[model samples]
Target: MATEAKRQKVDDGSESLQDFLQWCDRVGLVLSSKVYVSKEGTAADYGMLAKDSIEEGEVLFTIPRSALLHQGTTKVSSLLEKEKLSLESSSGWVPLLLALLYEYTPSQSHWKPYLSLWSDFKALDHPMFWSKEERVKLLRGTGIPEAVDTDLSNIQREYKDVVLPFMIRHPDLWNPNTHTLDLYTQLVAFVMAYSFQEPQDEEDDEEDEEDEEEKAPNPPMMVPMADMLNHVSNHNANLEFTPESLKMVCVRHIHKGEEVFNTYGQMANCQLLHMYGFTEPYQSNSNDTADIPVINLYKAATQGVQSDSDRRLIEERWELLCQMTQDKGAFVFSKQGCLTDSELHTALKVFCMSEEEFSEFKDNEGWEDDDDEDDERISQALSSEGLLELKPSWKQLIHEAARLTLRSYGDGEEEEKVVDSDRVLMEDRAAFKGLSCRQRRALQVRFGQKMILNRLMELTKL
Candidate 1:
């Protein structure tokens, strides 16, 4: 309670997306009141819809721990001193940017809680905060600057006009309490694990350079969220290591008026966005050539099919299923939260298609002209009142990955199969479409021999 008498506070609070939807309908998490706009929804990022059919992989919005501040230590003068927080009106520097998110979390196992944010800002009792000509301008703003140094751009324009607009005119940054987005999502996951941490972690390890001089920890800024998930690149949200809080049952179903997408680049297209800076917002939209199947598990650890810890567990479960389908805005593949009991039936017969291979293709004698086209397809899957079930093990793995792309052979001039499904290749549309109802049932359960006439031409063309 060191208020120094509420130092001219600011909270009348009204930023209202109807009080962020009456605090997300008093916290049950369902948001989709049909609000899509780009021309003027006023951009601090917004997009919504599903007034009706959203079945595929359902859950579209979530962030709880009573909407976040989970702290441990972030001492830049205590985000000016915690004053004990929580939404009964969060106080001052939003508890010092959520005590810089107790320094590294998603539930930290590494970066040792950012070394207690550099030993609590070098045990600050303000030992002249930073004078030795400001430690030679913080050791010349510790490199990575090249073209700007009017004394490190006047100390980062005096930390963005007098310390980040006095920590963005505090009053809990604004809103009865915004938890400054759990302190800007721990400063955007400490800026995407900050250029992948360690170069002897850029200084501050002293056992005795005359001992006391520590305060360096505030660098955290890598802005990815899967490069703000817009612009699809043949996505299935497999940013893979399977972390849906240690999976239990959703290999694929995700419907409810779909937008769910993920695949930053190459388990074939956009190739994990070339290792992840991501970019598609219709850069002149068109397929832009993406057959994308680049499987080098380095050759499943020199062609043994698995082990170098199962090829680093298939490259850390395909980069955490493309960063959990770009932070769960859409792509929703669920290995039942992920594997068990005989490795979850061998990862469900290796990622999906077996009701005993559909009764051994309905006992084939060329079964009465495929039983008059499976009786005009069970009367149009009972006149479309809920029927898109193709999972016979992801249709025998997308027709054995599309007949191993009609017999692989890179550096080509040999791809003219007598059937050209209009082969456009790129600028965007040719194969991938709005697909999601759990990615057309994991492409008919892994490719049910080209999804039974591509599921009767996408249910007689939608």
Candidate 2:
């Protein structure tokens, strides 16, 4: 396994790391002599390493805006704009994907050296590329299966509806045979894996206070050399944007031989695996989360309330929750097993309320505005005992739901196949090492979730 990882990393460092470094210089990307890219035997295969001891807040590298590959700088930018094709957060990453496709021809592309750093589609580990059986066998209960299906459906529609027509209209721009769905999908994976969303303008900080849902995000761009750093849950470096350039700055001191780690945000293991094709093992992801679907919670909450009138009452209570909190969907639990979602707690309290209690609660139109402080006080008061002190019935329902959710991952025997922690991996290396990369990652994702759910069970234990 280690040998395969090394080989793949070497293959990905095409044209050699030195050539890519020279390319970075030619394109106005400045790399601090303190750090350089190398073949890291870690999950990323290739990662930036500290060449010398670096102090906190030190700039590791700076990439000029001109060096970025996006719709604005691509060779087809003007043509795309002229054709009235604009990409935004809503329309998916088609714009950048298209630009990548257009610039992928080595002879024509100015980014030849830069482009050579990437491996072919075979090297990609995103679940979108997983076999159907593999996905079913390993990722049955996770959101990945549904997410991958939705992505494939959308990609096909995007290809047939938008991409094909655009390419067909301009035959010289792209070849149908060469820019096939397979290649388009590969570009999609690249965009997902490598693209960086342009930082929001600092001048718009005040305006950003508006609901984020109402805002259209800046287009994703490809930043050469910036995407090489590997990610860890507790990262020591961050990417900071300035008017002139995007800078990678160390947040803490990095000693020589230490990998210069950057964060991919406070993401859960599931999200990391889904987007980047790898996850931090042994529940080490600080931002790891597991979701218990609202429907599952509802099923658990209404397990014994079989009468039509009682069911109606429960349905009405759920409606009330939606109206009051706008929180439908799932109850998200953090890595520590604490329920991070207050809305879910409120929902549980509402459901567990007696008929008269619910009447009084509804008549009061939920808790008063000032109740937030009281809720906080109550939460603090309960923290000494447990995260949240739920009523016996409420705890029962949530515990049952947590069990059901865990069971959905598969049987206990199957769950035992994957290592759950770093210590365990060390103790039983063969259990984890024998599995395929995809299988190992799949287990990591599910097991990370299972760990979270187990914590949830503990939190709500009756």
Candidate 3:
């Protein structure tokens, strides 16, 4: 009976998908015969698939501008326009959210077929929907918990301060019972996960500089068929915007029966899991990065400095850094697990100088070229590799900082070291399969960070 029920569900889904495609055609959405939508196994429920071999540079589909769903194109646009100030003041996404809320509430909507594609709210995986306990348990050190909390707080505030007031005024158009916070939150998740920001036209850049500056950037739009293609780090297709329509074109050849992948820009694992509720396997996302906070470095520098005078000197040096530039953001490790940040290196150099040397350095306002020999030597030493050749104190500082950062991860348990060997990585990838989806994605995010931290420690020979 269970097997029969599963088959029935699949059949219903297939029919719904067909209806959506027919609706797309009626709305002038042009799809190439060589490409169609199909199941992508576990990577996603449905994705664009190659029905036959597709060549590079081939246009797979084109979506008419009228077919795109946003505040401008929705049937309730004029009604929402009356509340434009209220919507714009609350959030950039509010206009579209209101449109979607009203359109999705009624039994009949112009976007009924397109909206059906996203009917399964239960299937959403964005970390924002996860319980606070689940987020803490699975994603404690992944940086997603803080982001999820911020989004939740914003959603609650907007619903109370903006949405509730708008609904209360339009009692005849919208029922509070139907347009509840739960439904609004679901639509917000859809916007976060599925919407795409329309790129500004190049011609817009030539407009009066003052007028362009006054204009707000384009809001996110729900682009049907385009959003159906699942994302991968190294994807085979990209979306191209034209004056009249949006087109999906193949960037590389796709073989028959292969899934046609599109990229969501070069996002890291943490971002992928936070926004989309999924992540590429470990080591697969090329744009991955990890941040080590500046406070960690400061803590490391002050660890053994017992003199109150020295602590004051350290604080003054930090103030000088702040004066030079306001970028106190975290130092990041690149995809190759290397720290090539010049500001961080400069901070270390400033922090390492003795009191007298620091006074001279500050008097010079950070290294003038008045002494040619001294300037030449300093120039050579400031090269990328030279910057990495740290003093003993700087080396120890980095080592301690990385260790402290790792300790911030779950339960202070040491992360398993990942060797730079395919054999070890394959073993790890195989092991990833036994974990639940949430656990596996969480591990991918945290492990990616741990790998970078471990690599940094190795480079410094700690």
Candidate 4:
């Protein structure tokens, strides 16, 4: 019975997709005869694929700016003009959200065919849609939980302060009975999933220079047909914007039957899953990253300092290190499951020194140059061979810090069990369906972080 229901939903979605494509044709979108949108044997339900061999640098399609669904392109602009509504006080997202809401109305919307292509709210797998319990259980240690909370709170506030008042003024456009919180949530989800930021042209930037508050980049937009392309880590297609149109051009040769993919920039599995509702497996993702909370490391470094003077000195040194790293813009952690060389070196140089070594370095106001013997000494201490020479207790502290981070997720035994079970389930298509899409995506993110934490702990052991 459930299987039949699922099939029905897919069929409905396909019909809507066909309607949208037909609408695109009616509006004069120039699509290549060599490619078409259809289901590929991958996780994405719909993706564009090459029907014939295509060379690098070929133009796949071109979408005229007028066909895009934005304040400038759609009926929303006309209605706002008629109503004398000014959205100057609100964020760019406010007007775009209103534009989406306007087009979502069934009888009044001119863009109904395009709007109908979106999946129902229940189909959204974004972490924001997950229950608080699920977030605590799966995302407690990660930054995603806090980010999801902030996004939901902000959107709710926007609806109350901005959208609700506008709807009250325009009763003909929004009937309270039909436009409920449920619909608002769905619209926000669609925008989050589908909106594109129209790149700010250099000419516009020059014009805005005299404005005291530099205007925020032109609001993100919804590009019809263009949003249909799915992402791959190393994609072969690129989206370029001009004064007249948005173009999808091939960056590399696409073999017949291969999916034409677009790069979403370098993103971690966690970010991809949270924002886009899917994750490439760790092995398949070249850009996979693990976000380590640096605060955990700070706590670990200062844990055993007994003397207040000594503690102050250590804190001072740590602050200097942080500023130096920040100046270079290199403090971020990643999924190759390790800290950057600079981060590792900074942490070791700051925390792994004896009082005598630290005092001498401090007297010099920190290492001044690469030629300094003290600087070379600190560098050598961070090397692999120097690991055996370090005090075992200092090494233990680093191990304990990583272990604490992993523990922040949940019980070690339970986390391991869940990760192991999911790994096996992921390999079996039948078993995979037992979990919701968000659950599957969240598990992959958690698993990736755990692997990195384990690697960090191993480094400490060495």
Candidate 5:
């Protein structure tokens, strides 16, 4: 362990989760690919969630430095170049620093979590740094957007979702780094979440005639500790961070053995489902989209467990929980464990799953999008693009399921395409069912009732 890592450790006796991740090799649930897109229906796209209990303002989890690749894919020669420096820090200085950390570490296998950070940072709107010509020269090897000086003013003007906590105490780190070493100066958690982006108003664009479409600020390129809380729209997980240590300190008190969840879809269900790809567990009908509660997931992690599908889910899910917990949920940590793969995977795998199943009981009456035949509201057998996490086969099923449930976009242009009923049925029958009985049931919580209805509706739409 490096000196920096030691300094960042929160060895408060309150935590049952040890300082380092113990199960990286034995675990496969942590999605290794870090490049996740919020909107494009990626592997992170596990459909409808099973209902999990949570309270308002709970500290879902903490970010660990061990899982996060600090300098993110350091191509040393390219990064030093003036042009490519933009690529190194496009998400701000965070990736660049992580890349530096990656540069120093000798052990490659253990560095998966940190290396994954590079992709996440790049996905954000690249922060403008040097002049176009200078940047172009430096950006020779690694393929990314052509380096161009973005108007710093434009960046600030467009800064809501891309916000991060920063300490005014240090100008050096205002750029970005792997850890919070710079912010540690103040004893107090003086750090404030700041953004290179500025605020925007509805009335500011040119021509005033509604030519510009509304776009959200990109998800923060470098979540650092702030990304720990699983994505949830409600304040249930309520994750917060301090600028002083750049550590994401948990403000909400959590009980021991709870699965930590972050605010995954703090935006909306459609946004959450299509983007991160996991459909939150909720009952939806025309009269009740708002009533659909958005809650963060927290699994109760048992102290001991053996290898089994049930155990895998529990362990994988709770790995995030344990890392985020401090001394049995009593205290929260900041600026440490950024490199822990389990936390990174758990955070990345928000609603992600391979399949979901929904069924309507013989007497069940409630359903969504019943009238719209071409509705994409919920559907099956559809394709998705821009989903970065899951493999093509994994996400193909999600796309199909989503198509079955939702209203199709634009005059039924993107509606689900039909396959021969017999052929599809044969395929389902011929293939081996991968999940165990318990695992299948656990997965059904996301796709159970409404999803099945959507599939039935698709038969008519075609």
Candidate 6:
């Protein structure tokens, strides 16, 4: 929603727009003339805007099933079906990427005009496209680098085993020079940035129910013009799917010339940057989250040099705590990166349980048939007032663990610098000039996590 310059109008007479409209008409798609694709000032290069005032619930466009580009609708489906290519073992994106690759070739695709309007690969700033050195500098301490590496490995394997073999089998259709690994990476990025996982229809859900196995829903799909809408944390429009078509509808009233924004659900800055190459400031995003790696605490608790008996006791206590919490994996901070009282209570209980108490709970399988005394004690211990009963040593351990996790994000000097800044200036200057977008977004996530950890550590003091 930040605008730094005047909106530039795209030429209505442009050949690509004309061709896209003609193609839509040929495919029985209905686009309202009231909306047009145009510059979105500083938000994005292209976004759809209302040419006239639109009311809530009004349909902006409807894309028929025939116009969707997916495994089932693309022309390559027939060829893949002929080859008996079983996508059962492949990830959801595999078949979709193959379908996209097929459609991208010369003259064989009916969706070329629509595809021509896609954003350039060079312009994309998703972390997957970042240089190795950039990633090290910007995302070294974060989980994003590991995720990026995993994605790259999976795509490489898919290309080597599935896509490359299929291309080799059909050399006449796929020229080697045109189907390079670089193109595959770009297409994967394109799919990640634009694809949507549509919900299945009622009939399909019924069929899945009858089938007993209840397989996952079909792969995500590429919807051409619908992908052009820019995202805002508080969006005014959303996509509605029916058996016959996919419709984009105004979810709220819009004045004339206002950009039609679409919601991408509640995502954190890390997720938004990882997928869409953009980040919203903390003030604008109501659903921001930060992840605290509790696994690090588990490791720290178990791996220290200790007497054999002491180490065994610690491991048993840790295992019992994991069972009690159902190993919730990570301590997730929500609501603008602050944990709720209940969440803090849960963390405190998990971190502070004594070995004898854990053994008693384990013996009872969490109070399944608890005697009155045990039941009374646990009920009091887990109550809101029970937080006051935590031992001083347990509180110190929790405080130390929280501090260690925060320190893992950076060296001592950098952590001190981030903690010293006024929170307002940190948020306002997140996009500091001269920093690459990836670096800025990474900094925002790191800063948010440190702030949340600081608050959690303060609670331990209480």
* Model 3 pairs whose backbones collide: none
Candidate 5's error at 196, in angstroms? 14
Backbone clashes in candidate 4 total 1
Number of backbone-clashing residue pairs for each candidate, in the order shown: 82, 0, 0, 1, 86, 0
Overall local distance difference test of candidate 4: 0.69
- Which 10-residue window of candidate 3 scores lowest in summed lDDT? 1-10
User: What lDDT score belongs to each candidate, Candidate 1 first?
Assistant: 0.29, 0.74, 0.75, 0.69, 0.29, 0.67
Q: What ordering of candidates by lDDT runs from best to worst?
A: 3, 2, 4, 6, 1, 5
For residues 185-292, what per-residue lDDT tens digits would candidate 2 score against the true structure? 888877777778866776686666775674667777898877887778788899888878999999999988888888778888788777877777654677878888
- Return the candidate ranking by TM-score, descending: 2, 3, 6, 4, 5, 1
Number of the top TM-score candidate: 2
Stretches of candidate 4 off by over 4 Å are 1-11, 40-42, 78-91, 202-215, 312-331, 335-400, 412-436
**Candidate 3 residue lDDT tens string, 112-160:** 8888876757777678877899899877766789989988898989988
TM-score winner, 3 or 5: 3
Per-residue alpha-carbon lDDT of candidate 6 for residues 183-237, written as tens digits (9 for 90 to 100):
8888888777778878777776876786867677767899877887777778889
Candidate 1 to truth, TM: 0.20
**Per-model root-mean-square deviation over C-alphas:** 26.0, 3.5, 5.3, 5.7, 23.5, 5.1
Better of 1 and 6 by lDDT: 6
Q: Which stretches of candidate 6 lie over 4 Å from their true place?
A: 1-15, 40-42, 82-86, 200-214, 299-308, 320-329, 336-351, 364-399, 412-414, 418-431
> Which residue ranges in model 1 land beyond 4 Å of their true spot?
1-77, 80-423, 427-462
lDDT of 4 by residue, 338-448 (tens): 335446555656677777877777677665456554545654554445544656765675566776677677656554454465467656767766876556667667777
Per-residue lDDT value at 462 in model 2: 63
Worst 10 residues of 2 by lDDT: 1-10
After superposition, which runs of candidate 2 have C-alpha atoms over 4 Å from their true positions?
1-14, 40-43, 85-89, 208-213, 322-328, 337-340, 360-385, 411-427
